[model samples]
Target: MVLAIAGIFIVFCSVILIAVSDRHPDATEGISSVPISIISPFQDAVTGSITFITGIWRHYFYLVSTAKENDELKKMLSQAVEKKNQCIEIELSNQRLRKFLDFQKTRMAQTVSAEVIGKDPSPWSKTVIIDKGRSDGIRKGCPVVVPDGITGQVVSVSTYYSKVLLIIDRNSAVDALVQRSRARGIIRGMSAEDCTFHYVLRKNDIRVGDEVISSGIDGVYPKGLRIGYVSGVIRRNSGIFQEVDVTPHVDFEKLEEVIVFITPAEYEFEMP
Candidate 1:
């Protein structure tokens, strides 16, 4: 009812204003002034409503545009971070390869470089799988070494991969000599980080910090290649041999790339 009355009032006011204006062309005086004053307030309210609705519509679209732009910027930033990480990895790999090249130039034996791909899951056995296999001249009993020192020996071979028994495994052994006093001993794997130097006479002048190297008497590792250093020594009063602990030069946890000697079993070459 209120809406109908308001519509009727608007029509009535329009007709009166038109009729009054037509009667007196040049007169703005008596009747025309009353109707104009009555309708002015409603006109202003309608104009204000239209303006408010238009402002809300424009602001909604602007917020949507800003959200889309923010999403695109986030995506671009993620891609940039991924590319930077890849570049860093490539540089590190190149550095390791350079070190391998220097090692090959200084060594006398023929060797094939292989990447470590997998590790033995059994905690009792310290072994790692390499990318090289029988096709790459990697055979059982092939010695594996890194730039620092001996790593292990290849014990199992497949077409494209081989499993190496690391020097830390209990079954591994190498003939070693103390670099300082020429004390002869057999280095046997005792644990993940240490080995035992066996058969060293108690009378020998061996002490902690003495460097150990391969003797090449066993015909496996080359002569004078660095193995480890003596970390501890225990002498018994009655026993002729002393108990010695050795720490290998190679860090097995950080092992990545290794060199496998392809030379025959009897042809062990010396390292400079």
Candidate 2:
């Protein structure tokens, strides 16, 4: 009875081992559902980790590329703006040259063209610098002029530049004639943008709005070149001569270029 019982127990253990080893995957999953559930969660976690890693790499690459492009675009924009400003400056310079050329055509005197390069250093001196020099025939006391009227005189000359004493300078003087009465007088500079016509003799003849032109008597400037106009006549002083306040024909503050007039005697004789 003991031997038979041992043999049945051995057979039962064999059957249990075969049943566990040969079980279907579905049958195993049904038996212990936790492992299947763990597999799904592990697969999801692995897939999510891969997706997060890929997304981080893609965004980082995109940002790096975008920043590089933005820097390049900014450089291009700055260059374009600089080019635009340069074009505008060139256009304006061309326009000013055109007007300066027109002024050259009207005068019979030999001309030396010069650009205004500087303004008065001293507050009391109304002077400007011209680009012309001694080599260009610009000299001290030579009259300077523009299309509208006389500007000033060459006060000092150097190798590359000349100083012009403007019409409004305190030391400036011009022989001017009254356009209406044909009267002659000396106009003296008093302040910036102001002068006085001396030797008007009578105050009534020199009224407001009277024009003044070079008389040619002084031999410094040619006749009929405009100097300025009488803005007001001060007769209140009741002196022998009237004090006529004059505004200069040219605005010295905005002066750009001028022509140094070569006398007719010098130009006509020098022609070969």
Candidate 3:
């Protein structure tokens, strides 16, 4: 009975060991496979989760870097555009200055270069303030001019600035003669854009489009300086003088720079 019981016990133990051990068709060693089999699904799930999180982090970092690069590129483009505009403005200014230099060579008298800094707000008067004054040799009655034609004469002066009475001012007048027929007339300001030729006789042979130039008798402007052009002419039998309308060559509203002629000492105080 004891021998039979021992054999039975040994058979039961062998069966249990075979159930837990690895099944091999040719290998001799037996490795436990139950633990690994149970844990494989969990391991795969953990690895997949880590891969997904790492991918999302990398994508977010790439997006942030791209946005920063785009901002920097936009700023660079804006700066380039601003610099281009500045270059264009500088070129335009240089062109204007060149014309002034060319005009300066034609003048026989000394001149002071000045910039128009302000204008009179009074509607009854047309005048501009220049940056040069007595300290710069500018004086009252000094003839102011531009490249186009005669501008005005200085009527007031300070140490560093001067006021120029434009030809369009109601109080302004110049002794002018028609360039075509040598007809003499007094160019008087009538409005902001028009001047009237007074003392022009009806038989003076004046006509529209005739240029009026200074006769130098006014003692303010130089001889042959352009004052304006005759725009209209009317004949009347009752009056000795004809109604003549003149238009000045200078564009008063667009005045930016001027040249003040440094006249002789005797002509400084002779205001026109």
Candidate 4:
């Protein structure tokens, strides 16, 4: 009895649908319109969500690529700046070497160039070590000088290096004369940066700003070589000698290269 009732209901619904279609004659189109309208909003929503996600992915990848490129550019710029600084240092070194060369050509003595490699370890000694040594014909008592003025004399030598005793050492002294007054005095090292003019009489016409040069009477330093300028002059009515301070022309702290006047040689050569 149940099966017979279900079959009757299904048949009855089908008959009613057929009757409605027959009356409208375009019922299939009209019936589909309502469902299409309802499903169209859902389809459009899915498509918009997909497009938004795709745009975000593309923008994210673009930003990543741009960041990588910016990093590369920054690295390149840093390397360029370092190279420029190196070039400037090289140019300045070349200028200094050229000036040294000119001084060597004008000097009458035989000279060999040497680079300063080290300084005296003892605080009491004002000395520097040069790269040239016995193998290069450098010997003890060789006078060391630079373009500006006299530096010192070589005191010790090895096969590959030599030690120079700077004029600013306490034990060092030079016979000097005032260029303007022709007054004779001894230039003695009192400190690392200063020297004293000794044995000058109080009646001498020595004044500040006078240029002192080597007298060449000692037969060590050549004649007319600059020693220093008078920085201070103290006259005393009681003492036989006046107190005078001389500031050296060469700044020892900034010394890099020097010329060594080697004995028995009369040629100029650059330091390696």
Q: For model 2, which pairs clash? A: none
Please report, as a residue range, the 10-residue window in candidate 1 with the lowest summed lDDT.
28-37
Model 2, span 155-237: residue lDDT tens: 66665566688888887789999899887788888766789888878644877888899998887898889988889987765
The residue pairs found clashing in candidate 4 are none
Clashes of 2: 0
For candidate 4, which ten residues in a row score worst on lDDT? 32-41
Give residue 201's lDDT in candidate 3 (0 to 100). Answer: 87
Residue 248 shift from truth in candidate 3, angstroms: 0.7
| C-alpha lDDT of residue 232 in model 1 | 96
Segments of candidate 1 deviating more than 4 angstroms: 1-107, 264-272
lDDT of 3: 0.77
Q: Summarize candidate 3's per-residue lDDT along 1-272 as a digit string, tens digits.
A: 99899999999988766664435311322222233234433544554576578878977868969788889999998999999999999878765675655533222588888877666767888987776777899877899989778898987666666778888887788888999999988888865698999999888898799999988788888878887888999998788889999999988888878989986323222112
- How high a TM-score does candidate 1 get? 0.58
Q: Which stretches of candidate 3 lie over 4 Å from their true place?
A: 1-107, 264-272
Clashing pairs in 3: none
Positional deviation of residue 12's Cα in model 2 after best superposition, in angstroms = 99
How accurate locally is residue 49 in candidate 2, as Cα lDDT from 0 to 100? 75
